[model samples]
Target: MTGSREALPDVDGSGLTLGDRAAIALTEYRNGNHQALGELVREATPLLWHTVRAQGVEHDAAEDVVQSTWVALVRHAETIAEPKAVLKWLLVTAKRAAWEAVRKHRDDEKRRTELPDDSPEHPTSLPAKDPLPDAQVLSDERDRILWSSLQQLPRRCQELLRLVSLADRPDYRYISAAIGMPMGSIGSTRGRCLAKLRTILDEQGDFSWT
Candidate 1:
Protein backbone atom coordinates (compact mmCIF):
# COMPACT_ATOMS: atom_id res chain seq x y z
CA MET A 1 0.00 0.00 0.00
CA THR A 2 1.65 3.21 -1.20
CA GLY A 3 1.36 6.22 1.12
CA SER A 4 2.89 9.69 1.25
CA ARG A 5 3.87 11.29 4.52
CA GLU A 6 2.84 14.56 2.92
CA ALA A 7 -0.63 13.13 2.51
CA LEU A 8 -1.20 12.41 6.17
CA PRO A 9 -4.21 14.45 7.16
CA ASP A 10 -3.77 17.29 9.63
CA VAL A 11 -6.19 16.52 12.40
CA ASP A 12 -5.05 19.17 14.83
CA GLY A 13 -8.34 21.01 14.57
CA SER A 14 -10.57 17.97 14.54
CA GLY A 15 -11.04 17.85 18.32
CA LEU A 16 -10.69 14.08 18.14
CA THR A 17 -7.54 12.07 18.77
CA LEU A 18 -6.78 8.93 16.80
CA GLY A 19 -7.67 6.90 19.87
CA ASP A 20 -11.02 8.64 20.06
CA ARG A 21 -11.72 7.82 16.44
CA ALA A 22 -10.63 4.26 17.04
CA ALA A 23 -13.13 3.87 19.85
CA ILE A 24 -15.91 5.28 17.67
CA ALA A 25 -14.84 3.03 14.83
CA LEU A 26 -14.92 -0.07 16.97
CA THR A 27 -18.32 0.80 18.37
CA GLU A 28 -19.61 1.47 14.87
CA TYR A 29 -18.21 -1.80 13.53
CA ARG A 30 -19.87 -3.70 16.35
CA ASN A 31 -23.13 -2.07 15.41
CA GLY A 32 -22.73 -3.24 11.79
CA ASN A 33 -21.25 -0.03 10.38
CA HIS A 34 -18.57 -1.76 8.37
CA GLN A 35 -17.59 1.39 6.47
CA ALA A 36 -16.49 3.05 9.69
CA LEU A 37 -14.07 0.21 10.26
CA GLY A 38 -12.77 0.59 6.72
CA GLU A 39 -12.10 4.27 7.28
CA LEU A 40 -10.28 3.51 10.50
CA VAL A 41 -8.09 0.98 8.70
CA ARG A 42 -6.94 3.54 6.18
CA GLU A 43 -6.14 6.07 8.86
CA ALA A 44 -4.48 3.65 11.25
CA THR A 45 -2.58 1.18 9.04
CA PRO A 46 0.64 3.20 9.05
CA LEU A 47 0.67 3.31 12.84
CA LEU A 48 0.07 -0.46 13.02
CA TRP A 49 2.82 -1.18 10.47
CA HIS A 50 5.34 0.91 12.41
CA THR A 51 4.26 -0.65 15.69
CA VAL A 52 4.87 -4.12 14.28
CA ARG A 53 8.21 -3.20 12.72
CA ALA A 54 9.36 -1.64 15.99
CA GLN A 55 9.03 -5.13 17.48
CA GLY A 56 11.81 -6.28 15.09
CA VAL A 57 9.61 -8.08 12.59
CA GLU A 58 10.91 -7.85 9.02
CA HIS A 59 8.98 -5.98 6.38
CA ASP A 60 7.12 -8.95 4.86
CA ALA A 61 6.32 -10.42 8.25
CA ALA A 62 5.30 -7.02 9.54
CA GLU A 63 2.83 -6.70 6.69
CA ASP A 64 1.32 -10.06 7.50
CA VAL A 65 1.15 -9.23 11.20
CA VAL A 66 -0.57 -5.94 10.53
CA GLN A 67 -3.13 -7.65 8.33
CA SER A 68 -3.74 -10.34 10.90
CA THR A 69 -4.09 -7.67 13.59
CA TRP A 70 -6.97 -6.11 11.74
CA VAL A 71 -8.46 -9.52 11.21
CA ALA A 72 -8.10 -10.25 14.90
CA LEU A 73 -9.83 -7.00 15.69
CA VAL A 74 -12.70 -8.01 13.47
CA ARG A 75 -12.94 -11.41 15.06
CA HIS A 76 -12.89 -10.02 18.59
CA ALA A 77 -14.89 -6.85 17.99
CA GLU A 78 -17.86 -8.06 19.99
CA THR A 79 -15.69 -9.39 22.77
CA ILE A 80 -13.48 -6.32 23.24
CA ALA A 81 -14.41 -5.05 26.70
CA GLU A 82 -13.41 -1.44 26.13
CA PRO A 83 -14.04 0.22 22.80
CA LYS A 84 -12.08 3.23 24.05
CA ALA A 85 -9.01 1.07 24.29
CA VAL A 86 -9.29 -0.32 20.76
CA LEU A 87 -6.23 1.56 19.53
CA LYS A 88 -4.11 0.21 22.36
CA TRP A 89 -5.52 -3.27 21.74
CA LEU A 90 -4.56 -3.12 18.08
CA LEU A 91 -1.04 -1.96 18.92
CA VAL A 92 -0.54 -4.62 21.55
CA THR A 93 -1.98 -7.32 19.29
CA ALA A 94 0.26 -6.31 16.39
CA LYS A 95 3.26 -6.21 18.70
CA ARG A 96 2.56 -9.74 19.98
CA ALA A 97 2.05 -11.02 16.46
CA ALA A 98 5.34 -9.47 15.44
CA TRP A 99 7.11 -11.17 18.33
CA GLU A 100 5.63 -14.50 17.30
CA ALA A 101 6.81 -13.96 13.73
CA VAL A 102 10.31 -13.17 14.92
CA ARG A 103 10.32 -16.23 17.18
CA LYS A 104 9.14 -18.49 14.35
CA HIS A 105 11.80 -17.12 12.04
CA ARG A 106 14.51 -17.84 14.61
CA ASP A 107 13.17 -21.37 15.06
CA ASP A 108 13.21 -21.95 11.29
CA GLU A 109 16.79 -20.70 11.09
CA LYS A 110 17.81 -23.01 13.93
CA ARG A 111 16.16 -25.99 12.25
CA ARG A 112 17.95 -25.23 8.99
CA THR A 113 21.27 -25.04 10.81
CA GLU A 114 20.64 -28.43 12.45
CA LEU A 115 19.90 -30.19 9.13
CA PRO A 116 22.74 -32.31 7.80
CA ASP A 117 24.41 -31.13 4.60
CA ASP A 118 24.19 -34.36 2.62
CA SER A 119 23.68 -32.68 -0.76
CA PRO A 120 25.41 -29.85 -2.64
CA GLU A 121 24.76 -26.49 -0.96
CA HIS A 122 22.13 -24.42 -2.68
CA PRO A 123 22.24 -20.62 -2.84
CA THR A 124 19.87 -19.07 -0.34
CA SER A 125 17.25 -16.79 -1.86
CA LEU A 126 17.28 -13.39 -0.25
CA PRO A 127 14.14 -11.35 -0.10
CA ALA A 128 14.21 -8.37 -2.45
CA LYS A 129 15.25 -5.13 -0.73
CA ASP A 130 12.33 -3.08 -1.81
CA PRO A 131 11.96 0.43 -0.34
CA LEU A 132 9.24 0.58 2.29
CA PRO A 133 5.93 1.92 0.97
CA ASP A 134 6.10 4.96 3.24
CA ALA A 135 9.84 5.43 2.74
CA GLN A 136 9.17 5.81 -0.96
CA VAL A 137 7.18 8.90 -0.13
CA LEU A 138 10.20 10.70 1.30
CA SER A 139 11.25 12.11 -2.04
CA ASP A 140 11.38 15.66 -0.79
CA GLU A 141 14.81 16.74 0.44
CA ARG A 142 13.47 18.02 3.75
CA ASP A 143 11.50 14.86 4.35
CA ARG A 144 14.60 12.80 3.59
CA ILE A 145 16.67 14.86 6.01
CA LEU A 146 14.03 14.59 8.70
CA TRP A 147 13.80 10.84 8.33
CA SER A 148 17.57 10.49 8.48
CA SER A 149 17.65 12.65 11.59
CA LEU A 150 15.01 10.41 13.15
CA GLN A 151 17.26 7.41 12.52
CA GLN A 152 20.05 9.10 14.44
CA LEU A 153 17.98 9.04 17.62
CA PRO A 154 17.89 6.03 19.94
CA ARG A 155 15.67 3.18 18.81
CA ARG A 156 12.97 3.98 21.35
CA CYS A 157 13.01 7.61 20.34
CA GLN A 158 12.72 6.70 16.69
CA GLU A 159 9.75 4.47 17.42
CA LEU A 160 8.08 7.11 19.59
CA LEU A 161 8.54 9.87 17.02
CA ARG A 162 7.24 7.72 14.19
CA LEU A 163 4.16 6.74 16.17
CA VAL A 164 3.56 10.35 17.18
CA SER A 165 3.84 11.53 13.58
CA LEU A 166 1.33 8.94 12.42
CA ALA A 167 -1.30 9.72 15.01
CA ASP A 168 -3.77 12.56 14.49
CA ARG A 169 -3.10 13.63 18.03
CA PRO A 170 -0.67 11.79 20.26
CA ASP A 171 -2.60 9.75 22.80
CA TYR A 172 -0.07 9.13 25.56
CA ARG A 173 -2.19 6.55 27.35
CA TYR A 174 -2.45 4.27 24.35
CA ILE A 175 1.08 5.07 23.20
CA SER A 176 2.39 4.11 26.61
CA ALA A 177 0.51 0.83 26.49
CA ALA A 178 1.74 0.12 22.96
CA ILE A 179 5.40 0.89 23.55
CA GLY A 180 5.70 -0.20 27.19
CA MET A 181 6.66 3.32 28.26
CA PRO A 182 5.47 4.90 31.47
CA MET A 183 2.18 6.70 30.84
CA GLY A 184 3.34 9.82 32.65
CA SER A 185 6.67 10.01 30.85
CA ILE A 186 5.52 9.83 27.25
CA GLY A 187 5.12 13.58 26.82
CA SER A 188 8.49 14.45 28.34
CA THR A 189 10.11 11.61 26.41
CA ARG A 190 8.66 12.88 23.19
CA GLY A 191 9.89 16.37 23.98
CA ARG A 192 13.43 15.12 24.52
CA CYS A 193 13.26 13.09 21.34
CA LEU A 194 12.15 16.10 19.34
CA ALA A 195 14.85 18.21 20.93
CA LYS A 196 17.47 15.68 19.93
CA LEU A 197 16.09 15.56 16.41
CA ARG A 198 16.19 19.33 16.17
CA THR A 199 19.80 19.38 17.33
CA ILE A 200 20.69 16.92 14.59
CA LEU A 201 18.90 19.04 12.04
CA ASP A 202 20.61 22.23 13.27
CA GLU A 203 24.04 20.68 12.75
CA GLN A 204 22.95 19.90 9.21
CA GLY A 205 22.19 23.64 8.81
CA ASP A 206 18.99 25.57 9.33
CA PHE A 207 15.93 24.13 7.62
CA SER A 208 12.47 25.02 8.74
CA TRP A 209 10.37 22.06 9.79
CA THR A 210 7.49 24.38 10.56
Candidate 2:
Protein backbone atom coordinates (compact mmCIF):
# COMPACT_ATOMS: atom_id res chain seq x y z
CA MET A 1 0.00 0.00 0.00
CA THR A 2 2.55 2.54 -1.12
CA GLY A 3 3.72 4.57 -4.17
CA SER A 4 2.17 7.26 -6.38
CA ARG A 5 -0.59 8.42 -4.00
CA GLU A 6 -1.31 12.13 -4.41
CA ALA A 7 -2.59 14.95 -2.27
CA LEU A 8 -6.38 15.16 -1.81
CA PRO A 9 -8.22 18.35 -2.75
CA ASP A 10 -9.91 20.71 -0.22
CA VAL A 11 -7.83 19.57 2.75
CA ASP A 12 -5.28 22.36 2.56
CA GLY A 13 -2.92 23.01 5.44
CA SER A 14 0.18 25.07 6.30
CA GLY A 15 1.62 24.55 2.83
CA LEU A 16 1.30 20.81 3.36
CA THR A 17 -0.37 18.30 1.05
CA LEU A 18 -2.84 15.61 2.07
CA GLY A 19 -0.03 13.13 1.50
CA ASP A 20 2.07 15.13 3.92
CA ARG A 21 -0.71 15.11 6.48
CA ALA A 22 -1.00 11.36 6.03
CA ALA A 23 2.67 10.86 6.72
CA ILE A 24 2.54 13.04 9.80
CA ALA A 25 -0.64 11.36 10.93
CA LEU A 26 0.80 7.92 10.46
CA THR A 27 3.86 8.81 12.48
CA GLU A 28 1.83 10.47 15.18
CA TYR A 29 -0.63 7.63 15.34
CA ARG A 30 2.23 5.20 15.76
CA ASN A 31 3.74 7.50 18.35
CA GLY A 32 0.57 7.32 20.50
CA ASN A 33 -1.22 10.33 19.12
CA HIS A 34 -4.74 8.94 18.83
CA GLN A 35 -6.01 12.26 17.49
CA ALA A 36 -3.91 11.79 14.41
CA LEU A 37 -6.12 8.88 13.45
CA GLY A 38 -9.10 11.21 13.40
CA GLU A 39 -7.14 13.64 11.28
CA LEU A 40 -6.34 10.81 8.93
CA VAL A 41 -10.03 9.99 8.52
CA ARG A 42 -10.87 13.61 7.86
CA GLU A 43 -8.06 14.10 5.38
CA ALA A 44 -8.58 11.02 3.27
CA THR A 45 -12.35 10.43 3.32
CA PRO A 46 -13.31 12.69 0.41
CA LEU A 47 -10.65 11.25 -1.86
CA LEU A 48 -11.75 7.75 -0.93
CA TRP A 49 -15.37 8.78 -1.53
CA HIS A 50 -14.74 9.69 -5.15
CA THR A 51 -12.41 6.76 -5.70
CA VAL A 52 -15.05 4.29 -4.59
CA ARG A 53 -17.90 6.10 -6.33
CA ALA A 54 -16.09 6.06 -9.64
CA GLN A 55 -16.37 2.29 -9.55
CA GLY A 56 -20.21 2.61 -9.73
CA VAL A 57 -20.95 1.87 -6.12
CA GLU A 58 -23.97 3.72 -4.75
CA HIS A 59 -23.46 6.44 -2.21
CA ASP A 60 -24.29 4.32 0.83
CA ALA A 61 -22.18 1.36 -0.23
CA ALA A 62 -19.35 3.71 -1.12
CA GLU A 63 -19.54 5.10 2.39
CA ASP A 64 -19.17 1.62 3.84
CA VAL A 65 -16.35 0.78 1.47
CA VAL A 66 -14.48 3.91 2.39
CA GLN A 67 -14.95 3.16 6.08
CA SER A 68 -13.62 -0.36 5.60
CA THR A 69 -10.67 0.98 3.68
CA TRP A 70 -9.74 3.21 6.57
CA VAL A 71 -10.07 0.32 8.97
CA ALA A 72 -7.78 -1.75 6.76
CA LEU A 73 -5.31 1.12 6.53
CA VAL A 74 -5.20 1.39 10.30
CA ARG A 75 -4.49 -2.32 10.55
CA HIS A 76 -1.81 -2.34 7.86
CA ALA A 77 -0.46 1.18 8.02
CA GLU A 78 2.85 0.16 9.42
CA THR A 79 3.37 -2.29 6.58
CA ILE A 80 3.54 0.58 4.14
CA ALA A 81 7.09 0.96 2.86
CA GLU A 82 6.44 4.56 1.96
CA PRO A 83 4.31 6.51 4.35
CA LYS A 84 4.38 9.44 1.96
CA ALA A 85 2.31 7.39 -0.48
CA VAL A 86 -0.52 6.94 1.99
CA LEU A 87 -3.12 8.65 -0.19
CA LYS A 88 -2.44 6.31 -3.07
CA TRP A 89 -2.59 3.39 -0.70
CA LEU A 90 -5.94 4.59 0.55
CA LEU A 91 -7.34 5.04 -2.96
CA VAL A 92 -6.29 1.55 -3.92
CA THR A 93 -7.77 0.09 -0.78
CA ALA A 94 -11.07 1.95 -1.21
CA LYS A 95 -11.40 0.95 -4.84
CA ARG A 96 -10.78 -2.67 -3.97
CA ALA A 97 -13.37 -2.52 -1.21
CA ALA A 98 -15.88 -0.88 -3.55
CA TRP A 99 -15.39 -3.59 -6.14
CA GLU A 100 -15.83 -6.20 -3.47
CA ALA A 101 -19.03 -4.58 -2.25
CA VAL A 102 -20.40 -4.46 -5.78
CA ARG A 103 -19.63 -8.09 -6.39
CA LYS A 104 -21.18 -9.18 -3.14
CA HIS A 105 -24.21 -7.00 -3.68
CA ARG A 106 -24.74 -8.51 -7.12
CA ASP A 107 -24.25 -12.04 -5.89
CA ASP A 108 -26.70 -11.58 -3.09
CA GLU A 109 -29.23 -10.10 -5.52
CA LYS A 110 -28.81 -13.06 -7.83
CA ARG A 111 -29.38 -15.51 -5.03
CA ARG A 112 -32.50 -13.78 -3.81
CA THR A 113 -33.89 -13.45 -7.30
CA GLU A 114 -33.25 -17.11 -7.95
CA LEU A 115 -35.02 -18.01 -4.77
CA PRO A 116 -38.09 -16.03 -5.66
CA ASP A 117 -38.14 -17.49 -9.13
CA ASP A 118 -38.19 -21.01 -7.73
CA SER A 119 -40.62 -20.22 -4.97
CA PRO A 120 -44.31 -19.47 -5.14
CA GLU A 121 -45.58 -15.94 -5.08
CA HIS A 122 -47.35 -15.17 -1.80
CA PRO A 123 -44.98 -17.59 -0.15
CA THR A 124 -45.16 -15.59 3.02
CA SER A 125 -48.43 -13.90 2.20
CA LEU A 126 -51.95 -15.20 1.73
CA PRO A 127 -51.06 -18.47 3.40
CA ALA A 128 -54.52 -19.72 4.34
CA LYS A 129 -55.51 -16.13 4.82
CA ASP A 130 -56.74 -15.90 8.36
CA PRO A 131 -60.45 -15.31 8.66
CA LEU A 132 -60.64 -11.57 9.20
CA PRO A 133 -62.78 -8.60 8.40
CA ASP A 134 -62.67 -7.59 4.77
CA ALA A 135 -60.75 -4.44 5.62
CA GLN A 136 -58.03 -6.26 7.58
CA VAL A 137 -57.60 -8.90 4.86
CA LEU A 138 -57.09 -6.18 2.27
CA SER A 139 -54.64 -4.47 4.58
CA ASP A 140 -52.64 -7.68 4.95
CA GLU A 141 -52.65 -8.11 1.20
CA ARG A 142 -51.30 -4.62 0.66
CA ASP A 143 -48.70 -5.16 3.34
CA ARG A 144 -47.62 -8.36 1.65
CA ILE A 145 -47.20 -6.53 -1.61
CA LEU A 146 -45.06 -3.96 0.18
CA TRP A 147 -42.96 -6.70 1.73
CA SER A 148 -42.36 -8.36 -1.60
CA SER A 149 -41.51 -5.05 -3.16
CA LEU A 150 -38.96 -4.43 -0.47
CA GLN A 151 -37.18 -7.60 -1.49
CA GLN A 152 -36.87 -6.30 -5.04
CA LEU A 153 -34.40 -3.69 -3.86
CA PRO A 154 -30.66 -4.10 -4.24
CA ARG A 155 -29.23 -6.51 -1.68
CA ARG A 156 -27.49 -3.76 0.24
CA CYS A 157 -30.73 -1.91 0.63
CA GLN A 158 -32.56 -5.05 1.66
CA GLU A 159 -29.95 -5.76 4.30
CA LEU A 160 -30.03 -2.27 5.76
CA LEU A 161 -33.80 -2.24 5.77
CA ARG A 162 -33.97 -5.61 7.47
CA LEU A 163 -31.49 -4.50 10.11
CA VAL A 164 -33.38 -1.27 10.68
CA SER A 165 -36.60 -3.19 11.12
CA LEU A 166 -34.97 -5.66 13.47
CA ALA A 167 -33.33 -3.04 15.66
CA ASP A 168 -36.65 -1.75 17.04
CA ARG A 169 -35.72 1.80 16.07
CA PRO A 170 -32.62 2.13 18.22
CA ASP A 171 -29.68 4.22 17.16
CA TYR A 172 -28.23 2.93 13.92
CA ARG A 173 -24.89 2.38 15.65
CA TYR A 174 -26.00 -1.11 16.60
CA ILE A 175 -27.02 -1.98 13.06
CA SER A 176 -23.93 -0.32 11.64
CA ALA A 177 -21.60 -2.30 13.90
CA ALA A 178 -23.47 -5.52 13.33
CA ILE A 179 -23.46 -5.24 9.55
CA GLY A 180 -20.22 -3.26 9.06
CA MET A 181 -22.18 -0.39 7.48
CA PRO A 182 -20.87 3.09 8.09
CA MET A 183 -22.66 4.53 11.12
CA GLY A 184 -22.82 7.97 9.60
CA SER A 185 -24.82 6.73 6.62
CA ILE A 186 -27.48 4.39 7.91
CA GLY A 187 -30.33 6.91 7.95
CA SER A 188 -29.94 8.16 4.40
CA THR A 189 -29.52 4.66 3.07
CA ARG A 190 -32.63 3.59 4.87
CA GLY A 191 -34.51 6.54 3.48
CA ARG A 192 -33.39 5.76 -0.05
CA CYS A 193 -34.35 2.12 0.27
CA LEU A 194 -37.77 2.93 1.68
CA ALA A 195 -38.29 5.44 -1.06
CA LYS A 196 -37.45 2.83 -3.62
CA LEU A 197 -39.99 0.50 -2.07
CA ARG A 198 -42.64 3.17 -2.19
CA THR A 199 -41.78 4.02 -5.76
CA ILE A 200 -42.21 0.43 -6.78
CA LEU A 201 -45.52 0.26 -5.05
CA ASP A 202 -46.66 3.50 -6.65
CA GLU A 203 -45.78 2.26 -10.10
CA GLN A 204 -48.17 -0.62 -9.55
CA GLY A 205 -50.94 1.74 -8.46
CA ASP A 206 -52.65 -0.93 -6.42
CA PHE A 207 -51.68 0.09 -2.92
CA SER A 208 -53.11 3.27 -1.50
CA TRP A 209 -51.44 4.71 1.57
CA THR A 210 -53.92 7.48 2.23
* Winning candidate number (lDDT): 1
Cα lDDT, model 1, residue 36: 74
- Residues 1-210 of candidate 1 have per-residue lDDT tens digits of 012223333435477888877877777787688987899999999999988877777777889999999999999988887777789999889888888898887677656775454233431222333245375678777888887787789979988888887886567678777888887888788889989999999888778878
Q: What is the alpha-carbon lDDT of model 1 when measured against the actual structure?
A: 0.78
Task: Give the local distance difference test score of model 2.
Answer: 0.64
RMSD of each: 8.2, 14.1
* Model 1: CA > 4 A from native: 1-13, 114-139
The digit string of per-residue lDDT tens for model 2 on 124-210 reads 211142123455655776776766687689967765665455333543444444345565876777788889988998886766687
Please report, in order, the local distance difference test score of every candidate based on alpha carbons. Answer: 0.78, 0.64
For each candidate, how many residue pairs have backbone atoms clashing (under 3 Å)? 0, 1
How high is each candidate's TM-score? 0.78, 0.47
